[model samples]
Target: MSLRTLSRNEVANHNTPEDCWCIIDHCAYDLTGFLDAHPGGCVVLAQSAGKDVTVDFFNLHRAEVLNKYRPQLIVGVLQGEKEEIIPTNLQDLSSVPYAEPLWLRARFCSPYYTQGHRKFQKAVRRFFAENVNPEAREKELDGTYISQKLLNKLAETNILAMRLGPGEHLYSRRLLGGVINGREFDYFHDLILTQEFSRSHTRGFQDGLMGGVCISLTAVKQWLRDDDLRERVMEEVLSGRKKMCLAISEAFAGSDVNGLRTIAQKTPDGQCYIVTGTKKWITNGMFSDYFVTACRTDKGISVLLIPRGHGVETKTIRTAYSTSAGTAYVEFSNVRVPMSHLLGEEDQGAKVIMSNFNHERFVMVCSTARWCIAVVEECLKWCNQRISFKKKLIEQPVLRQKLARMISLAESIQAWLESITLQMCKMDYEEQGKYLSGPIALLKAYSTTSATEVSSIATNIFGGRGLTETGMGRVIEMFNRTNKFDAILGGTEEILADLGVRQVMKVFPKSVL
Candidate 1:
């Protein structure tokens, strides 16, 4: 099936609705059957029938839109014109230096990644680049919840299941459009999901999409008893039927378990518990059906799975990030939940919370590292294209130094992230909880602090455009505005730094260096 070239006159002759055609970037598209399906309606297509719409199309549609609509709609190139647009292929890594991590560069090899990792990485990257990024700006600005259509799309690709960070749920499942077997998924694969998804560059919408589930669900799957209930909840969440979030921080308490005011009391019947508390700055709380919550029990700090009920209420909390995150302040008044919903044991929740934090911090590390890379990419592209004083920004020595620092930080953090993720792949759950906790905390602290520097340098390089929300510097601006999120969330920098030292001291030799 070879493609034939169509003459301008020949294209003009197919202007009728029965045989409509249009030109986009010198390529002829037979959209007669698709006119009715056009989101802007048939009249728009009919009006442009037989005319070159390269400018108009590029103005309204992303460069990738043609690739999305091409297979079925494109007919051929105009007789004497050449195709100017090339579709993005995720399998193809960026040739630009520092644009992608070392493993993605030419002739580079990673001890941790196999062909399976590469395949899954390509699939996930393509999925986000094509599906998520196109709508991210709108959702981020408008503070709209992720659409069900997108959720269904993610479900179809097994993204939701994969985000849970390798477990029995993925043992027998296919992933990333069947590019990789779930049985082969490792921490590297999990790292790929976090890094690639963050490429959307809309932090708030990224969290709203599924960030909560990625963290909260770990506690559920790892600690919850009652096999049937756990299975049911996992199925519902992974299938995009129900939403869940972690509720730990409160207005009065942050980074302090003892400071929490939320409390749950057991009923005399011993079948249920009554929960009363308020959680503030909770990610995805406004839209969650279940809260993987921490509270003070009669014995000690505990965790419970509290379903949304009559006494449960949530109000939106606007942060530096968009409300699309579903960030909320939640109130629970006498909410009754079955004792079976208790995670781990009655008073041993400190361990349960500790177990989840390792992976949570790891996830943050992966995202923050990639975010730094994105900032570097933005600055690099800008410096190359932006002119100052009749010369490109890249020609300036000071600008080069800024780029060098940003790239150095991004690359260093990525190396640390990969090393840590490799350990995660080899270690079992308890082992990771036991040994990796301190390293993860330290890595998170380092990466986030590095990100602050990266963000500052990037904003300086971007100048006024860096502060603006739209246009070329949008990503830099967003990073500058929200990079503090990584520094503050999961655990504050000072707290995590202190925790890392404390954990190290636990194993410190009697005779130290």
Candidate 2:
């Protein structure tokens, strides 16, 4: 990595296209050989020849781009100069103010987080940074499915199991090579994992990364009557042998669960059912091997575990985000499901379906809040790196006010998220269902709504770059486009806000007359 020091006067002599050189991040690059191969072509290089182009370079490219061409293009350092912006180390916590949650900062403390949580966070962050992030960016852009090889790595590391949160599944396992015992895993660990995945900022790939298994398998474990069936499915999914998705939302019904049109008919023999229904906007549906489905029965709505086979069809449905999410329109045409595969009871499926909502929304809140904060980080970085009107964006009083609000929003979201997570850690399923549901809903609603605000302000700050899909404002662009997914994914902000108020209303105090 060593390079010889060269003076600006020395570098100025190489101005010709035949021997082009430029300074970026205090390092002198020999762009002569790279000119023809540059993605932006020789024109920009010719314009930048023999000049210190650090600001121009970053304004047009991410730091990683320099790293990509470092060995070949970087020839020397500018004499007596050093870089202020170092290439990012994925394993390192960001130094940008409020880029990370308060608990993660050096001096700030949260009663909710512990040393075990810290250790687990570091290990998990490093693991994903090394194993998953490169492919995440690639798959997110190329709109391809996540690979089995990486899925297996997730399984092998117990990352897949951890994503399912604390359960018997994690009891006997070692997490991230035993950085923390599985028995010791708590909601904080789960929260950390969720936030780390979101921090990667590959929104579509986030869902494709076993998101199905996280939301669907819990129902199988909780409601399926046949112990062997539940165990088999869990093993398959946790091992990445079979993928699963919760297929409940239909074209006609989403948040309104009862309005679902999918129907399951009991056979005369009473041994099986013929499920006939179409599910729209099913995440990971295109690649799922098993679907934890919802269907109307003779009595009421029932949850069913239907495998992908004859009569089961999935067609990709493009959303605002990448197709890497495997979002699909699913049709279950007279698919036969064993009576034993019924989750909970035939008429009591609503209980099973609703039971998953609290936890599912909780996880979504974790992701949503972290995603918003990550956008704040990107904005903060942009404010520092991006120069406008002869000064950095951060120096503008009005822009700084916008940032103050952003940082405040980010901090508030994380604080609320951690508070809810702490409550979750202390509460069991029934307790959470009774006491925490309303607050969690409110939090999810608030987080997504706040994200909406953050994304807009960020775009305005980035101006034209924020609208561009690639380059300096790509993160802002991606966030601006996909922030609505969180608002809609768990439940729309309106639905959740209503649910939150309604839940509290159930116990509202009667006015004194």
* TM per candidate: 0.84, 0.97
Q: How displaced is residue 203 in candidate 1, in Å? A: 0.7
Query: Candidate 1, residues 324-438: lDDT per residue as tens digits?
Result: 9999999999999899999999999989988999988998999999999888887887787676787778999999999889988999999999998888888999999888899
Measured with C-alpha atoms, the lDDT of residue 284 in candidate 1 is 95
Query: How many clashing residue pairs are found in candidate 2?
Result: 0
Highest lDDT against the true fold, candidate: 2
TM-score of 2: 0.97
C-alpha lDDT (0 to 100) for residue 124 of candidate 2: 86
User: Residue pairs in steric clash, candidate 2?
Assistant: none
TM-score of model number 1: 0.84
